[model samples]
Target: MNYTLHQLQIFLKITQLKSITKASEELHLTQPAVSIQLKKFQDQFPIPLTEVTGRKLYITDFGKEIAKAAERIINEVYAINYKTMAFQGEITGLLKIAVVSTGKYVMPYFLAEFMKRNEGVELAMEVTNKARVVRSLELNEVDFALVSVLPKKLKINTVPLMPNSLFLVGSEKLEFAKNATRKKIFENLPLIYREQGSATRNAMERFITKNKLSIRKKIELMSNEAVKQAVVSGLGFSIMPLIGIKNELKNEDLHITPIKGLPIHTTWNLVWLKSKKLSPAAAAYLEFVKTNKKDLITKSFDWVKHYDKERMLVKK
Candidate 1:
């Protein structure tokens, strides 16, 4: 049976999202358009590829196997395209990375110049919580991972890239704006948190346990943006990476709450497992960062250094 590559792409997306509506949104296609194509693709097969049970769609075991083959075919096609570009004397390949959610703010700046310089290279960055980012790196699913908090029990090499600082932040209009003690601030504001397995959440937990302070855990959000929105809405305060809340801080939507021990400092690092071999694009980026990290920081991350002055409020 002959099926178009477009159908295979749509089917793979369906396997990932598990809902036609969701897959359609991801593919930027209308729901009816996806449904019609899915039905056509199913007609070419004898057995059912997907089944709707209890009102939720589930891919059959056979469908999962087919999707795997589909993925390989799609990747092969991409390789052929890249190979043609390489034959033309251009640097071309996938440069895949997995980064923790807070890293979104810093990774883009680091990549901008590299991407500009190597216009033929393709970039795929997966932004997720720390656990998944580490898992992707551990499983060799990506060429590199960006992290502020290093993982334990993982043998890896890292190149330090940029400064990452976390501070207790609240709405600018937070009550008792000035002269509040550390414990008193905790008493006043319930702390919003990133969900479990998040680097920021882990940092917050370590701080609480180390200080032996009773923090009211107001709510848990899955992303940095969500936590920021909660804080800006006066729902609660959160410890956030300064890189992410820069705009909010500038707009007077949020402020750093200078506590006794805060503005937790960590450097962002590009990490890769020692055993994994790097592709051309990956190696290029690694070399680019190593050679130009200082210049990159000066150009794209000058504002990050301004937060060092905030460090004086808490001391080293």
Candidate 2:
């Protein structure tokens, strides 16, 4: 039985996401279309490739083996294409990257520069939550992933790209805006926090535990934008990436509360699996980031300079 590469790619996505609808969304195919292709591909094999229990999908043991083979086939095909392009002295191919949601703010700036330099390159970027981004990395689905916090569970190589400091921000109208201590802020204010699985949330939790701060009243939101809006409307304070609040700070829509021992400094990293072989484009990008990370970070996040000035004043 012959299976097209496209079908294999679709099946790979399905296995990774464990849902037809999610795979279809990622592939930009209708669910029925994806299901039909998946069914046709499964028909080629006598044993079932996947099984569904209740609402969740599970890949059978045979499916796991097929998935591994599919990955090898995909990677080798890409490697050969890259070799051919290199032989022709061409700097052109697909550059797929997955970035944590907060990274979306700065990554496009660098991608724009990269694209400008390599006009023949095709770029695909997925802006997803950290959990999905990590899952994508685990599945070797992207050349690189941008994250603020490194996943301790994954054996990967990482390059520090820039600083990703977290700041406590709230509506400017709040009485405790200027000089609230960590305990004071946590004990009195209603804090708005990102959903449980977000990298931002994880960082915030670690900082809270380290500082022994307890949030008394809190509102949980799923997205950074939601948390920011909630804070703007005086719903609560939020710990947000400094990169994400440049506009709000400039417009005075929000104010950074200089709580003592605050503004947790973290670094954004470009990460990839240590064992996977890199494509030419990915290798070039890794080299480019290595050589130009400092300048790129400054260029993408120049507003941080102003924040630094504010932090200095807050200290005084």
Candidate 3:
């Protein structure tokens, strides 16, 4: 029933970093001290808070739930502190964010701008896969997530950031023959693909199935960068977000070809749980996305132009 603030802080840090040594370093405590506090807290509760996998520490499910509660409690305490500081005309706090991998390419620009305007706020950001990003948001493990796909079952609020188009691309040397038809292209080349459960992979699979096309060979990869590398090496072709491959495309390391009824388009969404309370910093970020997303997309990406052209042609 009774716990020290240090205990809760340590739990939250350990859960965030998933390492005792890292949590200890952040908290200015020794590793043993961090472990002792966690142990004391766990002894009081019915379930263990953390488990060790090899040399790495993992917060257990129960520990994660407890850590979520601790985060909310800490945030509320900080809010009170912020109000006290605000009375003296000061705003200061840490903002934690988890973003899916592709968002890393763009969100940092917006975040840098936000940080410049709000000098008192500190940011902690983690770039993770879409599934982990969504799970972290669902569990209140992160303040918000910049993600590409929104889970249908979660009660969450979403602000649309930009539309992302998936492109079928390959090295210039391996480009589809100029006269090759869509069916011929699919039948002729091996396909480099992101692993299952990836948003890109899901979109690509849906398009392939809908069109009833069987790729010549499928090579599964783990990262967008890896897929690009594979395509650049002429290992195979891949479907990837246009934003992810802009530099390569520009450098002529990769070339894109249009498939009949291709280029699956989806939106990048900023998500937060409906029931979750946002801190001042988090609220500012949400507002920033709402007001500046259009300009952000327009200035940073050319995919929007491609999509607009395609849509206009479809309308015609």
Model 3 ranges with Cα > 4 A deviation: 1-90, 302-316
lDDT of 2 at 197: 74
Q: Per-residue lDDT tens digits of candidate 3, residues 215-248? A: 8888898888888899999988888888787778
lDDT of each: 0.87, 0.85, 0.79
Name every residue pair that clashes in candidate 3: none
Instruction: Please write out the lDDT profile of model 1 over residues 170-243, one tens digit for every residue.
Output: 88555654666677677667889899999899888898788877775568888999999989998888888998
Best by TM-score: 1
State every prediction's TM-score relative to the real structure: 0.81, 0.70, 0.70
lDDT of 2 by residue, 144-249 (tens): 9999989899999998877888887888655564565568778888877788679999888887888788788878998888888888888888889989888899
RMSD versus native structure for model 2: 6.5
Clashes of each: 0, 0, 0
Better of 1 and 3 by lDDT: 1
Candidate whose lDDT is highest: 1
CA shift of 289, model 2, Å: 1.7
